[model samples]
Target chain A: MREEPSQQIDRRAIRVWQLNGVVTTLVFAIITATLYIVKGQYNWPDFVSYITYGLAALTSIYLLVAIFVVPYIKWRRWRYQIYPHEIYVQRGLIIITRTVVPISRVQHVDTEQGPFLRAFKLSTVSVSTAATTHQIPALPVEEAEQLRDDIARLAGVDDDDE
Target chain B: MMNEMRHVHKLTIILYVFQGIKASAWSLIVLLFLGAGSDLNQLLNLPFTSFQLTLIILGVFLLVLIVFSWLRWYRMTYQLVNDSITIKHGVFIRHDRTIHKRRIHSINFTQSIFHQVFNLTEVQIETAGSDLEVDAVLKAIPYQEAVALKEKFLNLTNTHLVEEELPIDGEVEAVDEEQVEEEQPIIKEKKISIYHLLIAGATTGRVGAIFGIVFLLLSEIDNFLSEGDYERVVDWVSAQSIVAYFSLVFLYLLIVIIIGMIGYVNRYGRFSITRESEMLYIERGLIEKKSLSIPVSRIQAVLFKQNLFRMPFSLGAVSVELAGGEKDDKEAMQTVIFPLLRKKEWANFLKELLPEYQEDLSEMNHIPRKSFTFKALRMTIIYFVGLGVVHYFYSELVLVKLGVYLFALLGLYLLHRIPAFRRSGEQLVMQYFQVVMLSKEVAIVKKKDIQALETQGSRLARRLKLGYLNLSIMNNFLGRQFTLGFLSEEQLEEISEWYISGHHD
Candidate 1:
């Protein structure tokens, strides 16, 4: 059973991933720069003579492609099938992984907005079960709240024995 | 009898002083021994006349300090009001503390050999937090008052005598003083006698004590041999024939069994269990007396275990899992229920204690017959591979090692498949939830206690829509881990749903 308009998660998650990639690259750049400066003081070698510089360059390129391009493509292909009984999330880059969480087992659902996400007016939804926790990151704030209420209502009702 | 409550037996403080002196003496001796090889002779370089004087002066100083500490502690006193137990002590600090009866999860009373001789008891109340333990409520309260206070605290309904019941916002109305007095029962359940101690000792605690002794002996032997004399000992043993070796092994096992028996008898020398309306009380100990009471609702889980050796004796150990109970240093499993029982009596006892979980056993699911081949093959292969690695490393002794490998592999294969695993709908009805690892433990936890559930898929399982479900529960000290493995995806989902529904309810 599917809703009339196939439910699509907010596309802001792509931006969140892209931002994460940029922040990670900056952190590595600062660390590498410090090491290179330290090596120069010790007369070790130039930055180009170091193997780590080449590895860092490769990592930067990989992160750029993965963070921006991959998540965007996946988000385009992603489809969430949410029903009264269960919520199924399907998305992947190369190999698709589908997770089905039953509403009965949903212990609690939280809608969190970090400073960065709040600036973008986006919220992350986290659902905790007895044994696992799942997150749907960077949805529209309004949509995340709706999803939280719907899950809570579904969990509150006792329909299993039937 | 009332006089006993006011003054703690004089012997307790004396014993404390003695113990402190012993510890201090050991420390000084160790320091002196370590200093013997060092260039510290100058610091200790005293004239013979001065050395003798110094020794005498130091000894007197130590004695005075020990006596002072003992006297300060001796004056410490504690009393149990209707709702709270107050402890007041400390020579300089003058610390005064009170623990409410309602907040206390378990009350444990311990009497060491010295306390026992003086007819005194030490009571400890365990509360919810991790930071502090209320160790000395009444260090040497009269044994009878200790028992009465223990019973009073254990019975939740008799809260008026301990403390005025805190007013709930909207639920319980305050009761009058007359009603509170009427509720106090003069005679509580009689203190469990020494007989019950034997039963408890014969079961789990005794077995643990035996194992501890064996471990200690083994370590001592290792130490002695490692000191460069082991080669000589080994040469002497090697002079014996193969038959002699076998007999020596047999003798070792016999000695271990005898030690186990002694441990059991000593620990459970005087076991007793009495049930009040609100709690189950258990008291057992030989030289060191132990009394513990667990409330009915606070009991989280109950577990039963039966090893192959215990099968013949028709004996099993039943342990209760409760929150806020002191975890033993050795065993992580917190048992608040009956510690041991005959298998036949377990069903009746469990039903009496926890009627909510008692269910028809036939409805439970045993491990499917189809799963037997998988389990057997997996265990056998693991054993073979492990033995193969050992063999490869010690190829110089291949023949003898090969025989050992074969024997181990066969034994493991039989153990894995013979018993067969079983699970009831949501509740574990039988003693079958054991993981066949280094130490096998059977756990029976309520669905609500499960903290998290995870389903992992391999490449193949991902395709087949089948995966492994790992259920993590909060372990007292270890934080959280799981009794996890492969299961049918559908079954995993159903179990997850069941746990979720249970939590919501």
Candidate 2:
């Protein structure tokens, strides 16, 4: 926990994360609005309106946090480094997680690009073992591809069964 | 070697028909609820009565079902090639599956009442992969043929030299039981006696389930009785003397115990484990007898688990985690090697049955006492939230508050004792409590078997110099994860470094 991984994800990851946060906040806003509409259409009790108000307040607070606070913290904390025998990754906002995936146990490595990532020229590299998948999100597209290739080459076709 | 395709036993059609009926039981119930014997006949403009119409429809449905079952039985065939078994089945869309002898992880045989009546057996073959479904199923085969098949496959590539001519109907000549018996290099064998079965049943800890079922039945009975009758019954109960009430409670407990015993006996009455040929053969069940052969190489880890009742008696169950198999509703990805054993017997049991997993687990490193602060704080928050919910429902019960606090204290105490780990040679022995109450497990996993090692920490945990460790290991298709929280950051680093460097200190 004292030392961090050697590398950080693409700086543009902040924008991507902010976009994801915006979409989540929008979904919450829609849910709160629906609750309000339902409360108005039905002869709901007073507590129902209070619930709607509380939900709206919470959603707004989440929206502010998502836009201004989360993306930067997430971008700053996300780190990864590839060693000869293992891959180390550090991530998460509230609960920081450090993961070690042994290279010999790696089953496959893949690079993925969603619309937002593609627009930002970024790709997410996911390394899969037999049981779990670890992802380094929002890396420069070429760098992500190179990382995937490096991991796949280093993983090398071990004969042991998972 | 069976180079030609052969059909299963002729009883498969009958078995398939019964299976179809069982599968469509919901629709049959719905039809009965529709009640074609009633005034619905008047609503229909047909010449025949609704009852006769219903009968005619049912007869046609039965005919179709019989035809489908026959077709399914006719279409299904299997052939054993040099190193693989190829199965082709399905009535409409053909399914061809080839399972290599080397890849087969387990061969399990199940005998249902129907199979027993007809002297047939159902064979299931499992392979290592991501698929949750059994790789191949040979549904209704002669009991002797099933045994021979299991023996042959479990023997792996040894039978290539004995390429005996196949019989005319493709039925495997039952290998002489005595001849095959001599070939087994059995390392150890253990069988549960009737006395142990009774003890296991008594300590199954399923009294809660029996009580729940009884309560559900009583509540359902309320629907059939009039309110006045219900009140009279209640009044009669309330009017009983204290001795009678005590007797009633005693009777309820006796029933619970009896039911638990019966259930346990039925499931594990004839349980046995035999170790031979780099495989562990497990056979259990009194009526629906099931025999499973697990290749020792495929086992990912060994687990020793103790429930609350079993813990008091120093009894625990031993199970092994394997990668791919049909999702068994009862035990999921684990196969129990020992349903009940004394705590002291575990070392000897593993040494004899699975020498690869035998390791000294006497000296486990406990987490720092400071780690308990985070664990206790988390438990307190959860306790307060649970108390809030319970208080919302029943505010007048002071005993509820007292019980909740006491329960919370017990949980914190248990948490205080858990999250211990030790590395020995190439294996890590982890001991922890499950999310459920009073159940603890210790897993002995090889370093190579672990998929990933993860350490996580929150701000509070960081301040306290504590972290959580999660280890992933393949179990079924998706795998199972074990989490141990509230470890010192240095301990977390040491473990992670050991995993990465494959070095033990």
Candidate 3:
């Protein structure tokens, strides 16, 4: 018996990316404190804060690359099974929520890229229904376009004119 | 033709001026009060001369603007032809809005006491778009002409023209236009009456009066306590003695009954709903009589509401949710339909108004009995928890407050199981969806207007193989929330299938 793909979404991975959040906070705090010290407003107690900040900075650098960069690289290897009946998209570290959009209710599909995403040559695909909008962010530009076209074709909305 | 265009009453400008004056006076009073209460008098302070000058300038500007507005309003004209209604107005930027007859959803006529006295009516033409209201004051258009224009627009002859012209492949159009006309349905509609209006007034107007009285009593209680002398208060209380209280209560009840009567009389005074070949014609209202004609195809949803109070009287109101019109104000729903009907009459009335949904209604499954218990339990828990928290926090400030909370909890518990409910097949049907805390609504939503169907399952529900189904419809006035909870897995699947099939069909 073949287990449904829903099982994959229930699994968990250590979210090392959270350390990047801590590092980013530390970097911004250090920059602000350095500016304050240069202006002669820094206190010694506050100055000692940079020790924890330095530790966070070092750990975050490793965590960021391990979590974000590695995921982006490995995401290509990950496969999403899309069928006429259902679609399953899976990619996450800690918490995972697998969203299901029935094909019959799909109204329209859009592919867009931001500046950061453009630099990465990646795009986001958003599926819009009358009631709600769902998105799959940061796919390869070509793959995103293909997904959009496939979804549109499946939804019976002709994108040939566009 | 411009010269002959009927201007709104001259008093209309006077009414506007009065409104502006009232607004300005209230603002000045509030400012004075704030200035006196706070130490910010300097900010509001003005020398006598400056104050006089400011008032004079403001008054002059107000007067000039009022006169200009009146002139422009008086110059506004509207005309109804066979195909459309046209409104023309403007002082600086001339605006001529023409609404095709087919696009019109409803025509509303309003007559205030002043308008009634002047025998003038304000005609409001509602179309589908949000920003459009083609309104013009008809300076006494013969009631007959207004009725005739309404009838003309309600006739579906114009709608059929477009439908017939559309090309159909491999289909023989054997029927001549005359034969087709002959084959078109002629609906026999009932006329509203003084009695119906009385019933509407009794039910609707009495509720309004009760709320009004409660509001007045609450507002005046502070004044009665703080301002009145002891003797005066005693005198007032004495005036409300047992006999006096009973008499006053009786009189209030009588007044409510009268108002109900008046509401019915006003709304259904000359009510006549007729069908003229593929169109529904409704002529109603008293002082400012209105006539509306709606095409059969344009009907979006039909709703019928029955209240517990109205049940004994066998009075219900039916309203059609039509497409391509701005939603009426929330209060308008009360007087939107022919009011005060018996439950038995609903089936026949609905069949006459909407024959398409009759089969669907028969196939509807009743909400499971367990669902009501679950709903009741949920409501009870929410109410009790909320009550307990409030009492724990604000025990001192709340008045008769614990008793009130207990009473409210009791009321919710009772009403939760009032068997207020809904059922759906390939179509949507809901009964006693709450309108207010006290009132319930029953409506039939068409399948096409349903935008989406969502099935949600929580851990408990998933374990039990039960889920909640929500249907989102296009009508905003009806609100977007339609929850059917505690349905079995099979029921959920069936509901989804029904929703999908209905939409496609």
Candidate 4:
């Protein structure tokens, strides 16, 4: 039976993305504040002065959106599946993309997690082929392992070196 | 028995010199032209005789190439070990390469007109994973040695090598079958016709090469013939009428096209692709003979390419991609299965060669109106941006600028009407509309052969329920990626569902 890529990632990814977004917003705000302080010292150019104000407004809006909105949407959209003969991934914020990786061409499979993802018990499954690598990010650690093993078995790929 | 690494034929030195000059002439000419403004006069003004200086420079150039050639020749060596081929080469640093018999992509031999007279050929052995660093090349090997080497390579693999007969394994039943198969080894042969050559040459429009050369030479001449001393020469030439200059250009272009056509005909003259057992044998060239042996299993895909001019006539070239082979379209022709053919023949041709990929793609689903709207909005934004830039530069051409925008909007409308998709069992063909080239390019992929697929969306696109779909296949060096953007929600659902499942009979 035909269907869309059904499996979604661990919902903690939303919290992780929101936290990262907050950090980004903080960084942008700090830079803006520093620029305004510099502006306090001397008269900035007309264009530079205008840009500083615009950046200040944009970052504040970004901080609110990232902390409250974008993460939830990103989490809602992301999906992936490892079938008997293919791996499917559907993701994107503004443009939704659906991706498929056929098993026969798979060269290898890997499970990796960053320090942040590790704290949340999440892992990324990377499926490699002759062409490029596809990553299914933020799956539960056990699920990522299971998916990796399943893909390797289906693809019949031995752990040969690149 | 010990396997010994061997050097190629000594005559490779001559081949190297010929190749060195051919490769270096353009760069050397460019250097001369760039220097002609100041350096030539300064050299002429030197106390030494001009004749002596010229001879010294020529001597030095030849010495460099000769030394370089000697170093390369000395370093290059190949060894045919059990079930593998090892090559070692490099002037200062050593690159020792070992290619397994099973991994070999193709073994090709090239004999240029000069090598033809000398009865020497260059054998190039390429593997599935070759890249920039190492290319296995035997510069010049004698015909008999080359043939023997090819047989040895094939014998090691113990596959269906049709060109050479090997003793069957000790089974009487198998021997009888093998004997019967040996008598019917030749699969097919296709020769390019002169009529096909003319259509391809005229449609290709490669005569622009002359225009490129002439324009470069013209500017160089202008730079050197400035008002100080060459004023008389410039004036005498500047007296020509507009029509005369146009006629001269036309005449030159005509000559160039004729030359280009001749080159095309010579390169593809008597071209034929033959199959024997599991290997495809491509032999072509009028003045210089070249033959290639490629295993049918290694061919990743058959890719078709045609410009607008060729498309109307249903003529297109088809090349089979080999993993890790060169990607440039011009070099792609060297690996082309058929240089040109009518559209009607595509299905029949593919059915014969790759039966699984055969499909009827004459009709397809029309994209949702949202795709057109997305493109129109994007184009409008670009038009406005362009209008702003043009206005900033020359704001006075308001009517002309609007006219240009109007023309562009019409083109976008045309683009929206053309995209199509067709599926046949496990095979898929995407007729993607390329607005920049104003042509429709197609990608024919087997679902089981697909390597990866992806869907991406922007925040606005998600709100509008649209997305971009991209898929990759391992049939090429980088794995050919085919992508379609601004697909509607319904369309995205259809494609995403298609990818999530396997193609079953």
Listed in order, each prediction's TM-score against the native is 0.64, 0.89, 0.65, 0.77
**Over the full model, what C-alpha lDDT does candidate 3 score relative to the true structure?**
0.57
Models sorted by TM-score, best on top: 2, 4, 3, 1
Candidate 3 or 1, higher lDDT: 1
Ranking by DockQ: 2, 4, 1, 3
Indicate the residue-level lDDT of B414 in model 1: 48
lDDT of candidate 1 over B1-505, digit per residue (tens): 1212244556657766766668788766765555432434356665545445446556776778777767766667665565677676777778777787667777788888878877888777777543334434555667887777766665645554424445654434345554556665432343323444344444443455566777788768957666457877878889999999999878876776666656665555556666555677777767787877777666555666655545456665666655553654234455635545666675566566555555443343433343345545655778679868876777577677667766766665544432322345565432333543222334556555555445555445455544444555543332344443344555556665665454333
- Docking verdict class for candidate 2: medium
lDDT by residue (tens digit), candidate 2, B1-505: 6578999988889888898999987897688568753445677656876678778767877899999999999999999887689999988899998998778777898888888998999998888765655478888888997777776777543443233434334344444343476565656899888987888788775767787898798789978999999999999999999999999989888888888999889888799999886778888998998888888888899988887878878888898888777455365457788888887888888898999999886789998887776666787888789878988998897787878787877777767787799988789999898875457888999988999989888878887788889999987777788888778988888888788775211
DockQ, candidate no. 2 = 0.66
- Clash pairs, candidate 2, are none
Candidate achieving higher lDDT, 1 or 2: 2
- What level of docking quality does candidate 3 show? incorrect
What tens-digit string does per-residue lDDT give for candidate 4 at A1-162? 134588989999987888788889889989988988898788876777787899999998998899888888888888887666567777766566666776766888899988778999999999889878888889899998988888888776422321
The candidate that achieves the highest TM-score relative to the unseen native structure: 2
Ranking by lDDT: 2, 4, 1, 3
What DockQ does each prediction reach against the true complex? 0.13, 0.66, 0.12, 0.40
Q: Taking the tens digit of each residue's C-alpha lDDT, what string does model 4 give over B146-221?
A: 7777766652344334322444555545755766765554476677788997677766645566557766786787
